[model samples]
Structure formats: C-alpha cells, structure tokens
Target: MTDQLPLERLALWVEKRPDAVWLSQPVNGQWHDFTWAQVDEQARRMASALQALGCAPGERVALLAKNCAEWFIADLAIMLAGLVSVPLYPLQSAESIDYVLRHSQCKAIFVGKLDEPDKLAPGIPAEVMRIAMPYPTMAAQYTWAELLAAHQPLHEVHRQSAEQLLSILYTSGTTGQPKGVMLSAGAFAYAGSQSVREMQITEQDQYFSYLPLSHAAERFLVEMNALYSGGRVAFVESLETFASDLRHVRPTVFFSVPRLWTRFQQGVLEKLPQAKLSRLLRIPLIGKLVARKIRKGLGLDRARILVSGAAAIPRALLEWYQSIGITICEGYGMTEHLAYGCFNRPGQVRFGTVGKPMPGNELRIADNGEILLRCPSLMLGYYLDPEKTAETITDGWLHTGDKGEVDAEGYLKITGRVKDIFKTSKGKYIAPAPIEGEIAKNLWVEQVCLMGSNLDQPLALIELSPAAREQSQEQVTADLAQTLQQLNAKLEAHERLSHFVVVREAWTVDNGCMTPTMKIRRNVLEARFADQLGELDARQPLHWQ
Candidate 1:
C-alpha cells in the first residue's frame, strides 16, 4: 500500500491523468462526466472562494446535501483549505442536522441540491454562513457560483500533516446522541489503502454513489476508494429514480444496504409471477435466460462484487443471489474502524459469515464473547469525548460492541450486539439478530425484528415481500403458518419464534423505521411497537397477517 495520504493521492492523480473521467453525474436525465483536472480546478476555485469569504484553515466546514458532483467538490475544497469536512445526512430529521452542526462547531455550511431547503433553513444558526450550491432558489444566506467567480485562486498546497484532522463524521445515532468520529489524514490513508486492496478495487471498476456519503462505509467505498484507485464514481440522480439510474450506469461494483437488496429481490419476483416463476424454473434454458434478464434489469449484471454492510444481511438472500449467478460478499465493520474490517474474499466466500479480518487488522473474541479488533484502520479518537474514546480502545484493541466468534476456518460470524441481547421473563437469553436472519432467509420475509424482552417466547415483526402480499389473504396466512412451524422446529425451545406480526407498511429511512444504512433501529422499533407487542402477547402464540 502507498504511504501517501488520500489528499496526496488525489493530487497525484490530478497531475498525472488530468483528463481521466473521475466522476460521472446524471442531471435532468442527462449523463455528465468530470475529469480529474476539471474536479481539481473547480475545487481550487471553491477553496479560493471560501478563503475570500473569511474562512480560515483548521475550521470546520459542513456539507449538507445528497450524493452529487458538488459534494465531492466541496469536500476537496475543504481539504484544499486545510479544513475539516463534516458531511450531514440530507434525509435526516432537522434535529439531527442541528445536533451535528452544533457538535462539530461548523462556522460555514454548503447545502446542495436539497428538495426541502425551507425546512432545513429554520434549523440553521443565524451566525453560521449558509451557502447554497450553484444558485439559490430558496434564498439561502449565500450563493456558490458568485463566490467562486469573484475570489482569486489559491494554488499553494496547505501541506497537511498525517495527524491533521481531515474529517469529523457524525455517527448515525441509532442509539442516542451522535458522536463525531475524528479521523486524520494518516488514519484514512492507511484505512482506505487496506480497503482498496481488500475490495480489489481497480481503475476499471465503476461504483454507484447512492448511499449517504455521510456514512463512513459509502464515503470510503465510493469517494476515498475512487480517488485512490482512479475508479469512476457515478451519482444517482435522485432516490426516487435510483433504480433507473442504476440501469443507465450498469456499475461494475455496487454497494448497497441489505434493505435495497431486499427491494431488488422483490422487484425481480414481482415481474415474474409465481405461475411464470414456476414455469421458468421448469425449463432449464428458459430459467437461465429469465434469470439473466432479471439480473441485468436490476443493474447487477455487470457487478463483479455486490457488497452489503453496515448491517447483517439475511443468509437466505445471500443464497438466493448466489443461485442467480450474483455473489454478494457481506462485510462487517464500524465507523470507528474506517468502515471495513473483514470482507469475504472474492472467490472464497461464505454465506453466513462476515469472513476473516483484512490484512493488518486483528480480530479475537474475548472470554465473554465480545468481538475485539486492533488495526491501523482505527480512528484517531472521538472528538471532545476522551472518556468514551479511552473506554472504546483499550490496550490498542477497540472493543467492538458486538458479540461473535471466529470459526475454525478464520471466518468471523457475528452473533449480535452486546446490548441488543434480551432476556425473556423465563430468564433465557435471546439473540434477535441470528433468529431474524434465520426467518429472513425465506424470500417472502423481506424484513424481521425479533421481540422477546420480558416475554415467554420471541415474536417477530415481519415485513412481507411484494410477491407474498399479492397472494390471497388465506394463502398468505397458510404460508406463514407453515413457514413458522418449520422454522420453529429448527430452533431450540428458547430461540423459537412463537408468534409473528405482519407489518403491512414497509420500513424505510424516510419513515424513521430504518437507519440511513437500512439497518433496523431496534430501540426505536421496540419503543414504537411496545403497546402493539403487548397486545400480541395477550393473545400469546397467535399469528397476525
């Protein structure tokens, strides 16, 4: 791996292959490409603009927007000016944005291509300089293009050290208050280099930039990795048209949360009804043709590696995709570790395990079964939270709050979160993640949350597949009963799912049912359905459709 930092690598790329297309964007149904030279020039101009506007080096500059060309430009500008970049999730609640901005102490922010700027404007502090991308329609405090055109270019490199603060990424806050993870150029350089090697990212690889860049995984996978490897990064036009955009790009490598993968499965099944599905399965030639068509239509045909992380993927979905010629390698990591810790090797992949730790990272299970990791990928420390930082990293090993064990072949199998394990009133400990993974293996069960805290046996909150809901209510009920009965037989007395509640409404990030990474927020789910779950227990062992 190169010892050069991420910014250094970008500078080198800009100098060497200035004309290579580094970023691709689709605006107004038209695809646009930007070369490294174009990106560097624009970034420098933006940096000059910020400097002219009384922005100082080492100050925090936040970028509040979705995935777009401007996000990259703003980030590079921040780096160029030797400022720390804090990316805020555009889809998050106003309260979340406010918390991150205040915590990071951002003096200036760029809100780019927002669908609801009016809602966000109320949350911004009057003291903070609010800048809008391109031109403003919502009348933000400042505009981007005008500032860039008036300011003199600053071409001199800021020359940041390895320990200099590069970014301050706020956590998704699935639990409580979000902690800003402070990362340095050295830390990200080491982490991104290792990730690039593990992911086998090459210049030929094309990545779809759809996930929230505010998240570590996507930022590293799409942005940092793209710069290091000279790979092309494509931004989806919008969330509503992500599927269409994916088809247009046909990215060689796609990164998605498990939730999107579930939707992809539903889309394929919906197009081919059960009758047609059965008939196609019967004819070998036709089955292959139909499956290929389905994969291509979902923009997964050319995908050399379809990765899902930030949450556990259902083992069933893994197997199903494998059956259709697409190999999904699930990874396991946290924000504190710079996103990737262990990823299943390209060919030597496993369905149920998160694979062995990547090179330069150590993984061991503590006596109590907590997954422990020590790596260069580790963050410098949490911003302004020394107590928490010290507690998280002990003896150089980050005590990942997850419980898991390494298999004989060195594969790491995550059991569940240490705090997420619940005890039944009967005093039996129940791990919901593994049980949910077992149930979600069924194609019909798109999403499941196991609920058993202070109960006799566990019950599941299940979201149905699109194809499953198309069936008659009687058919759906009968199918659920049979599937549950079979699933129960596979589990021990304490682990068996006793009842299932069908959730008609889909869980989404916008709906607050899921995180930006598509992981179900268990604490939120439990709180929201506390009364409903109590009603399910009153009629214990009952299934609701």
Candidate 2:
C-alpha cells in the first residue's frame, strides 16, 4: 500500500522518465506512441480546457470511447481537473447510453474513438457540453486540437487523497437496471498496488487492452495496472485488424473474457483439426515446435500471464489450452469489489478452482451457501441508492450473491448463483452452472443455458458451434441426442434435461441476451424462450428452434 496514489504515480513517472513511452495505439496501419511527458502535458491542457468550459471541480464528466491513447489521456485529464469520471461503453445501445447520461447527470462528456459515433450521438443531451478527442466523432463544440491550441497546461493539478471518490462505474446489467458502483481513490490504489506486487508486474511489462474500459475488469486489470506498474499499453484499432494489432503488440501480460478465449480455441482448431494437432504434439521434438508456433500464431508467445474472467470457463476448455502449453488462469470477482478477489496464481495453476483470496481480502461462506467478501477495495456504495447499497454491504461484508465452496487448502470453486437455483414442480432443485458447464464441453455446442422454473424437468437451450451448423441437421441432432443421453446418466432424475432446443440465433451483447462483458443474461433468455420451452412434450427429447 506504500505505492503512490494514482495521481502521484502519474506525476512521478512524468518527472522520473518523461521520455519513456507509456501508451501506443494502432490506426490505419500506423502506430501512435505517447510518452509519459506527452501524456502529462495533454492531460494538463485538457484539465484547464475543462475548467474554461464552465466545468467545476468535483462535477461528473463522462468518457465515451473505445480503448485508445486518448482514452487514457482523457481519464487522467478528468482526474487532473478534480472531476469524477463516468465511462460509457463504446458499443452500447443508444437507449442505454441515454439512460446512463441522464442517470449520472453528467456535466460534460469527452468523445473519442467509437464503433458507431452517429448511432450513439443522440444519446447525449443537446444542452450538455461535448468535447471531441483527436479522432473523428459526433459533432462537438470543443475539439482536442482547439483546446490544446487555446490553453496552456494547467500549472496546478489536483492532488488525490486516498478516500476521495474517483469514479462511478455502472455495472453492465445482466438483468435489472445498471447501478453505479462508487469507487474511491483508495480502492484503486489498494487493488492496483496489491496486484502489481502479487503478479510481479514491473515497468518492463506490456499490456494489450481491447475489452471495454467501462467494465470494471478491464479498467482495474488493464488500465489501472498499467498506470500503477508503469507498464506500456497498446490498443487495437478495429475489429477487422484485431489479429494483426494483437500480433504487433505481442503483449507481456494478457487479459481476456471467456468468450474471446472460446473464439481463440475455435480459430486454432479450425486451422489444425484436433486429431491432427494431437498427433503433432505426441512427437518429442516436433511437439515443442508445434506448441511454440501455435502460441506465436495466437499472439500470446510473450504473454507470461494469461487471465480469463467475467464468467466460468469450462474445465475441458482449460485442459485444452493446457495441452497447448498455455495455462489460462480463470479468476472470480465482481464490480462491487473493483474485481479484486480470488485468482489462480501464475506457476501454481489449479485446475477447477479460482485460487485463494489475495492478502487483504476476507472470505466466508454464509449459511445459505452465498460467498461473502470484505476488503478495503470494496466500493464506497452505489450512487444515490442508499437502500440498495445498504442491502449489498452489511456489517462491512459484501454479499456476492454467488454460491461457492472452498477447499481445505483455500481454493474456491463456484458452485452456482444463489438466485439461479430453481426448484421444479417435482420439488427438486437444480443449479444450472455445473450442468451447463458439462454440456458446453461438447464440440457441437457453443453456448448453453438450462432453464426450468416450476417445470417437470430442466430443459437446455443451446447455440450450435459454427462447425456444427455446417454439418447435416440429422447428423448434428443424432450426435447431440447421444451426448445428451450420456450427460443425463450422471444427473439426478429431476435434474435430467427434458429437451434439447437447438437454437440458430446467437445470444450476443447487441441482442440483449448478454452483458457487455459477454456473460450470458440468463433471466433474459429464460423469459425469451418461456413460451417455446413450455410447448415441449414428452414425445421427443430434441427439437430445433
């Protein structure tokens, strides 16, 4: 905890190593690197520019952008001006964008790189001030170039105190309205400094960031980590150039959600079939060569630490990555605690458990099986919602709402969500996560959700993998039915799946069936398919929707 607070750390870097590059961004086949001195100068200028535009200290300022050098600069500028930052998701629907801006009552917003600038333009209130970044964006009254030209760097900067409120991060809602999680400077300092030491992160490390900075994981694990550890960060330009950009960065520490990890596996398997890959790995000399080539191809050759979070990854998937000499460490945490919790340590990798809690976190299981955590990095509270905040944190303990089991050696295995367990009409309770995890191991399945509320038996709604969709329907169905039968043998009578409703529609963030972080919205899917699921009969076990 002795590491300097965020602002102080930035100041230290600016003074100690002004010439060192801190951020780089790829754009249109060119790389833009920003040194510490440059970042400090721009941030200082923007801070003055904000005050000149009638923004007062302590007012909320929003940032709407994808990951870029300017994104980091704008965040630091917000802090420099003594303003609170509210980051909006780059690809969020206009409705969500509108809701957040209104809910936060933002005084001004800094616009930067985005996917659909025009589509999200209407979300900002016309009266609110708009400050555009260097990149093209929706029309704004103030531009980065104009601001830098008009104002000199502010001589005085806001020195942050540990307890001061830093930002309000709205949780990417899986079911209900998104609540703003209030995090203080101390939270970031605690988590960032702790993680830097625990992971042994140093200035020599490199970070590749693509996930939404609006989400807590990316903000904490990537952005804050870079600032605290004095590491260099590179951002992807576009979806089309993700592979090339990732290859170019060849990051030292990589963080990704389970969805992307799944896609990476699919991409590798598509090029080299599993059978052929397995055969190549059997040879002593060729195995090492083949594994190294695969790592380089995936742009993870230099990544000493590969992390997966935001959802539970299947054990079989982890095993597959292990076979390729890549150990994907799956961790567990939530936005309420700034995403600081249990994690599988590097080199001491565990298979089925998210490793023990970090040094300062306290973990305990409630009588009802819910996991409770208490830590210094826990959020101050939800913004303007005392009742909800009170309910979430009681006696200094945060109710995680997730059920888990910890082994004697302190490893924790998430069993299921306390709210996700449902009882069938036959009075048997089912936890869908373990069942869904087992179902997801099948090659034909891409995503699976088990829903059965007051029904005779739980039914599975499955999204087919690309390879499965290319196969004949009959063959796919026959293979899936056999797989279902084998899976049911291991479950209790009531827990056995009654139907396999193969769905063609993919559940994605844009479709409202997934959170921005890519965790499936179970409640949304359950309600969406309620009628279709009810129409099932005992006549057949499988059907296509």
Candidate 3:
C-alpha cells in the first residue's frame, strides 16, 4: 500500500473501476449516483478553471456549503490545483465567516446551498472570485456548469508530498475565537489507514453522510475513509428525511455523537414502549426474531461497526443499546490528532472507558491529570499562531485539555475538562460535566449546561426533549426536581447542584447556543441567561423558568 494523497487514490479508483459509484445525492425525492470517472473529470475541469481564474498554488480557497456531492468535488478540485481548502461550517455566523476569510486571506470561495445567501453574501469580499456550486447563488461570478464548460480538463496530476499542507480546519470555538488547525496530507493518510484497519472497512462498505463535513471526525471517518477503501457514500437530503435515507442506504458502518444516539433511542422507544420491548426480548426463541425486527426498523440491522464519539455517552445509554445486541465502540480523539488517538476494540468491550491507544500512538496521563498524546498523525500546528501552537504542543506531546485516568488494562476514561472546572463563590472548585452527565440520564432533559462562575453553588439550565414538551409544565418540573434530588445525593458538598432551572427556549445551532458539531457553547449559554440568574435565590434547590 502506498501513502499517496486522497487525489491519487481517486485517480487509482478511476483507472481500476471507473464505472463504480463514488457519490450519491438525493434530489426531488430520488437518489442520483456519480461514478468515479465522472468525479475525476469534473474535479479536473474545476481545477483547470481555477487556474484560468489566476489562483496560484498554495493559495487559500474557501468552501461554504452543506453536505452534498458538489462539496466533495470542490474539495478535490482545490487539492488538485495545489491550493489549500478552507471549509466553513454552513451554520457559522456571517461575522465569524468574515473573520475566518480575513484571517486566512482566502482568494476565492466555492459557494453552495446556504440558509440565507443574502445575509452571508456581505461576508465575502467582492474582490475575491466566486465559483458557485450546483446550487442557486446570486453572488457568484460563474456557475459549476459554466466553469466546467469554459476550461479544459487538467491531465497533469500535481503530486503533493506527504508533508504538504492539505487543509486548514477551523475549530468550533466553544469558548473563544476559532483557531485554524493545519493538517498535512501525511496526517490524513496515516489516520485514514488506521481507521480503516480498526473498523475493518472494505470496498463493499456503504456510508451515509449526514454530519457536517467540516468537522475533523466526520471528514476523517466518512470522507477520507471512503477515499481510502473505495467505498460508496450517500448524502441525506435534509433532517426530515434522515430515517428514510438511513433505511435506503443501510450503511455497513455508522458513527454518531451522543445527542443523536439518544434521539435514536427515544425514537425506537416511542414506537415500542421500552418496558414491553424488554419483556419481549426476554422470551426464549422469540427474543432473537424480535430483536432483528427492531434493528431492521431502526436501519441498523446491516450495520457491522457501530461507533460513538465527540462527547461522553452515558453508560446507561450504551448498556441499553447493548441489550438490543448493538455494541457501540467509543472513540477518543481531537482535531489536533486527526481524531486517531484511541478506540475500544470490537470484542474486548469495556462499559465506561474510551479504550486503549491505537498502534503506534503513545498516550500518558500528566501530573495535573490531563491526557497527553504523541502520534504520527498529530497536526503540524495552529495556522499563523506560533505562540499559541507552542503552548498547545510541548516536548513532542499534544496536551489534550481533558482530564482522564488510565486503568490497569490500558483503557482510558475521560473524567472532565480542566478548563471546564469552575470555582464557586465559596472558594471551592467543582467539575460540572460529571454532574451534568448524571442529570442528562433523565429522558426528559434535552440539553443541559451547568453554571456557577461566581455564584454560591452551581445552577443547571435545561431544555426539555420534544417528547417531554407535550407534557404539562407541572409534571415536567416534578420529574426534573426528583431527578435533581437523586443526583445531589450522589455528589459531595461542594459539587452538589444548587438549583435546576428549566428554560423554555431550545438551544440550537441557529440560536448560537450550540456549535456546528452539536456541542453546547457554555459561554454563550451563560451570557444568554445572565440577567435571569439574579432573580433566583442561591438557597433555592429547584426552580422552573
């Protein structure tokens, strides 16, 4: 096996199996397939067009789009032309987008489907060239078809060295300004191979792409893995059609975050009550048949490898899925490491651990309880921020800000974040994540953020799940209060929660309370609820907003 760039792999697939399906997209309630040969031709044409427009090699080009076939084509085109691809999350604010464009000095951008084109148009400077994707855009200089038709197909392949910069992926910036992560071609090639080996991926595997491709986890797991293994990729049309799309694709490999995994469990429980399903599964011969039917209905019957990452999943949730015959292998990684640190193996399952480090990757717990890592796939550094980069990576070890512990069997379990631990007014430090995770075990809670920056004790701001929204407010409050009481009993004196405040407004990407990858923005949430906190007494144990 050669350690070639993704474009080289694409070229190999084009020569070996030109007619094989490379990408699939839904349009007008139907799926359309794009063959490897077609992808190659379009990417080359786009590359040629970029050169015609005076795009120099090593210049930055931005991509702003939702998940689609055109996004992948544009990325390959950028790499083919020897330019760096800078991907912007579709849900990013116009101000943040403008900041990134200015910071990266992007010369051009490929625009695709956006929620509000007019609102985002001002972010891109008029001097920069704009090439519209296969979507409607009023601010583009040329469309996809026009560009492809106007330029010749580029036949000369620009072979990039392993150390060549591949892309600059900006973080979601939960606390501060987003940092541009500089990843090289060699980093991706190494991480991709490791992922394929760990998951046992093959050419026959199918992947359903619904997560934002801008995140490192999705980019590495879905896009890069498919390129390495010559697998087929299917894109979901929209949120409403996710279930139907999953059923249609019946993917062999599935990866999801903690929130979506909980939603899936809630969906199945809604169809068949959890108590009845458990009773049915206890039967002698009918158990296996019933379990298969349930898995099929949830579009997971054909899934060979199920994985979860991006956040700590509740142990109860994993146990529930295991009861139904699905074992979710939790993975641990970050953008700095190309999301390739460690993973729970298939058979040697541990209930509450993220598992051992992968082959060739070194992991250790620091004296301060922070998890440190040294891997071949580690990123070069943060783009244009040498001082910050130096602070992050010291002595060949990348300091993962997360606190963790390693067991005797080499399994690693993340405890909480070092930065996330806050001090109360009483001069005691409390780690709110573990407490929040305990409260999150309650089915009614959709999202929770613990706040106690300078207050006497920590406070929980919660948003109820959709199913819980149907219940009366009184019933919801009673249930939440009971859950909070139980959680407080398990906590120490300083770590106990002072009050539970149920917020009426839902936290979502559009509302700026959530990052693109579905992680809660603690600073944003605290800012939004700053004024109301003064109304509640610190002595109160529970209150409903």
TM-score of each: 0.95, 0.98, 0.96
Please say which candidate is ahead in lDDT: 1 or 3.
Answer: 3
Higher-ranked by TM-score: 1 or 2: 2
For candidate 1, write residues 216-314 as lDDT tens digits.
Answer: 998887888888788999999877888899988899888888877888877877777647776875688988887788888998899998788888888
In candidate 2, position 225 carries an lDDT of 91
- For each candidate, what is the lDDT? 0.83, 0.90, 0.87
Candidate 1 matches the true fold with a TM-score of 0.95
Q: Measured by C-alpha RMSD in angstroms, how accurate is candidate 1?
A: 2.1
In order, how many clashes per candidate? 0, 0, 0
What residue runs in model 3 are displaced by over 4 Å at the alpha carbon? 537-540
lDDT of 1: 0.83
Query: Where in model 1 is the C-alpha error above 4 Å?
Result: 135-138, 274-285, 537-545
Model 2: lDDT equals: 0.90
Q: State how far residue 430 of model 2 sits from its true place (Å).
A: 1.0
* Per-residue lDDT value at 434 in model 2: 95
Clashing pairs in 3: none
A best-first ranking of the candidates according to their lDDT comes to 2, 3, 1
